[model samples]
Target: MGKVMLARRAAIAALLAMRRDDLFVVTGLGSTTWDVASLGESERDFYLWGAMGGAAMIGLGLALAQPRRRILVVTGDGEMLMGLGSLATIGIQRPKNLAIVVFDNGVYGETGMQPSHTQAGVDLLAVAAACGIGARLDVSDAQELHALAERLAHFGETLFARVHIAADDPPRVLPTRDGVALKRRFRRAIGIAS
Candidate 1:
């Protein structure tokens, strides 16, 4: 049988349910942002409207600034591929509170579900390990997702996770697009006076 595929929306919702208020989230360009926004709006979520491939770096910055809080970067494979170089930089920085989770549906959902590099033999998990992020995980099923969510609370090392999700486009549920507002609210949530 083919490998089991996870529903992106469901998986994201499951993760967010376990989220601690202080755990800041930085979302990537399209669906990943929408997936998080769909549940509800929160000051802790810094949703990137059009910033493709920049999520990981943003998370790294937040992680460094708020060493006591966890920073999670949730992005898609296509977005991750665009910012592949950031992985190397992240490894060098090695922020213990930062974790990046790529929702690998193997397609660029924003551009109409075109097959992406991941579909053509790019192994993101290996790339992450190569970049020196020692803690790597491959989550394909519900069990793994649950484990990943649980692990999110306790990780103190730079961690990378690739979640295999189905290439199904759900309705676009967008978050606030004003970048300035996003920055202000996120800053306030993290205890920084904006």
Candidate 2:
């Protein structure tokens, strides 16, 4: 059989379908941010607008601060490549509640679809494994995606996955752009008074 390339929106929808109330999400800028917004906005979602390579670090901080809640970072391959060092830091910190999912379409979706390192044969899952992330996965089909989605809710260790998605641009679904409002809402969602 030929390789299976998952659709970005469908993959994201499945992953979020089973999201629990305590799941905290940090979305990288561009496509990933759009994907999360498409699923429907929530106070638990922290959408990054300008921090190009900081999603994982933001997730790490959130994971550290709210140890009881599950932290998920969804980012595109370009963003993940930019913040590659964050993986090493996360590996060292070993936050059991943290998981990172990269939608690797092998291109910079926001930047005119230029081929990315993943397209050049860079394996992010391997890098994550090298950084000591124990639960590393490369999802290329629907069944694997479903299993990965299920694992998101109950993951016990720091996990990372690179999901191969189609390189098609979908309609952009935007969330609130006000930084203060987002911070306030997220803080309030986690039980912190603004």
Q: Write one digit per residue (lDDT tens) for candidate 2, span 1-194.
A: 15767889998998888899889999998899999999999999999987999999999999999999999999999999999999999989989999999999999999889999989999899999999999888888988888998998899889898888999899999999999999999999999975
TM, every model: 0.98, 0.97
Residue 147 CA error for candidate 1 (Å)? Answer: 0.3
lDDT of each: 0.92, 0.92
82-147 per-residue lDDT for model 1 (tens digits): 999999999999999999999999999998999999999899999999999999999999999998
Report the alpha-carbon TM-score of model 1 versus the true structure.
Answer: 0.98
Q: List the candidate 1 regions with Cα displacement exceeding 4 Å.
A: none
lDDT of 2 at 182: 97
Highest lDDT: give the candidate number.
2
